[model samples]
Target: MKRILILFVLAGSMLSACNKFLETKPEDFVTPDNYYNTEADLDRALNGVYNRLVDNFGRMYSRGLFSFLSISDEFFYKNITITNLKVMDFDAGQLDVGKLWEVAYQGIDRANILLENVDKPKMDETRRKAIKGEALFLRAYFYFVLVDNFGGVPLKLKSTNNPLEKYLPRASVADVYASIVNDMKGADTLVSDISSYNYNERVTKTAVEAVLARVYLTMAGEPLKDVARYNDALIYADKVINSGKHNLNPDYSRIFINHSENKYDLQECIWEIGMYGNQLGNTQLAGAVGIENGVECTDDKIGYSTGPLKITARMFNLYAATDLRRDWAIAPYKYVTNTTTGVTTKTPYTAVQIYDRTVGKWRREYETVTPKNRNYNSTNFPVIRYSDVLLMKAEAETQVSGAPTAAAYDAVNKVRRRGYGKPINTPDATVDAPAGLDKADFLTYLQDERARELAFEGLRKHDLIRWGLYLSKMQSLAVDISTNAPSGFRYGANAAKNITARNLVFPIPNTEITVNHLVTQNPNW
Candidate 1:
């Protein structure tokens, strides 16, 4: 996936690397009819669609979320007084909101263009099917983003240059999810298996199933409340497990360490966004992953990060003393590096002072790329991991069977064992979930388990929303901060305090409402 992107990036070293993405288009020079006839051209177009996940500031892995979902229970943006998206203080006109909206549509349009032209390429039938599947998967993914963030958006399926097709009305939420399920289910049969690619960056069969599991699980909760979909979610999750394509990476921290080092862990990470060198040199595939969500540091050699993201006390308290993930996911120490000699030194944080610590999951110290940029690094973001699949199975299975089934307990226990640095397949009485918990108690256990295992990974807020706990959780967190947080840091509570019912779905960007006559603002916006 990154191969095609890197080729175009190196084509013109003197030019701005950001502008090279436009080369993916046949619009400037080669026409679609002539361009879509070749395999190389198809690859370029596919890369264009994938690049949507890499566009620095607007991409999912960027600082755009220091205040959104990622900033919920697990962490908070340190500059809390600011009245922007980070603190839930902005409106539809906010610049970041508009940029993200534009970027998602850009991805959708690129996918649509490629899908429409895919049949013209006289390539191998299998390869053509794979390419089409990838496009379909990506388009559905972008729509998922829109539906998750903006409620329902105009579903743009084809490459339409006509204004009539462009200015469509919003689709209903159920219709959007129906389309997402259909597109991804079709893609599941067409894409290659995980074994087909050396990197997890490309779309694979397991990735499709993994995301389908998430979709069905989301559909079973919150606004949708289609509880019957729990069975469908369970089926998709089991499909991935039964496929024998993935397993929990033995070391919990190794998963993210691999991400920072540009390595793939196919056994655990089913799909990750591939990121390469800093925008400097021959590489242009980096984003703000480590730079925006890691421990704060000023040394470029050690990997500079203005990562103002700090771990919340609520999240830190979830981990037990023996859990290896506690120290890795949330920084247990602060950097005291000697800047002149670049001799790195980190002082361990005392247990009582863990509240001030930062997100350590994507530490820049492990990043292998040299001459790191102040704002960018080559840390790949996980789209779906095996642990997530296991957890989803545990939740969905519980919902479908009206209790924690034997398989459900096993699924969660594997993740717990791995977190405790024990053999993942072996039983661990000390750390595994206690047996015989009822449905309500099991879900309560899962809420804490998910926070401990998957925090600061951009999934917390959505999980809260789906569980119908977003408002209540934030309100409680505000109370927690008001009573316990330091005076300077009390401002961090604004994000939780500012949250309201209208915050459920971000307002459709004013930029879109201004141009798209058929589209209207979200309720209360």
Candidate 2:
């Protein structure tokens, strides 16, 4: 007999009596008629959806991440596929996109299935709506990622009983956005009004709002360029900030540390991926330091694993020498002494952190697994933070008017003030960015501030792309991505000039073009 997955329990449970007690009974593992008949079943089903986040690094990392990271300035290798890497040329026809396209749809499919079958008798009202909201938000979030990256993707709003419908044609971007906004709007009403969910694992109303703000801001930026959207973005962001549920943490360095995992700091973080690692004697390290210093015993090296995301020299120079974030950015070459050999070996590796210039922001304490290896560290990734909301509000305000407004400055200053390690200051020295900054200039300042405040958090590419500064940034990155002097391949100062705008949006992966007939290849693919 073939083994059936637990998700099929709902199908089995449906054939039995519609009694409330019958909903709690379990039949064979495959059919829903046996299971998924109760409140707990829905909860577990929602858990499965949350569980899918763990696999995102595998699927989304390939396509969405590559596209997001390809701000052209990020990673900068010729061989890296995605955005504008000089080290790697990606063919829009590449098949890797299929995995991303499939995984997101699968998640959406699961959401639809839950939505359709979850409304059984005896389900608790609050729990039911919460589950529905989460599923809806997740479906919306996944579609948002897909549509943003691929232009328009197949809109599979309902659960498909037929496998044949999987090949549906692409929907228009407008249609996709409409669905995303609607789903999120509904979700916002249903989700609980909490800022942090047991350390930010579960998404809340603010999470919906955060993404809504992002959606509006993105619309204001690209193919839409609707200046009117900025007002909507500002409103949503303002709502989240004024909710007064979050605040920045006192220590900026500790925010990403494992010991501080799930601790809600400044009202800044609206949503983040909550993670806990195995504490069973074995250790794990943060990706930044582990991948670079070769101190990690996990076989992940910063130089190798972090080649593309390294910090740029220009970024390093932007920080004030006294800033704590700067300390987190660059770790000094550390030497571990071997107790047995009485030998002190220096880990002499100095690889770029966020930019070649700045130090790595994410760090974890390394436990020595071997003479040269480290064992464990636990750190979580922040998906949406309050600081981003403020900045978005600032940008929106500037765009709505002509120059940075006092409100915009205050919002920007709040973030900068916290980073300054002082009482939150508005119009203070650190918060006192040039007052006369025009809309165009203020926009540049916002981009740089985002780089400073949110670097390595994965928002870099999105900001660069929206600003229309990706090509120029990528050229600077191209020179850096090329073989450095010590590595033999060299590009002079002028060599960076060779990079072009054609490289901005990544070629639709060659594999995707080969397989998906509906996708129109992006320009220069």
Q: Estimated TM-score per prediction?
A: 0.94, 0.79
Instruction: Report how far off residue 202 is in candidate 2 (Å).
Output: 0.8
> Clashing residue pairs in candidate 1, if any?
none
For model 1, the local distance difference test gives 0.81
Worst window of 10 by summed lDDT in candidate 2: 12-21
Question: How does candidate 2 fare on TM-score?
Answer: 0.79
Which runs of model 2 end up more than 4 angstroms from their true locations?
A: 1-29, 32-35, 61-71, 74-88, 93-96, 258-266, 276-309, 330-359, 366-378, 479-516
lDDT of 1 by residue, 72-111 (tens): 7677787767677778898889887787777788778878
RMSD of each: 3.3, 7.0
Residue 35 in candidate 1, Cα distance off native in Å: 1.1
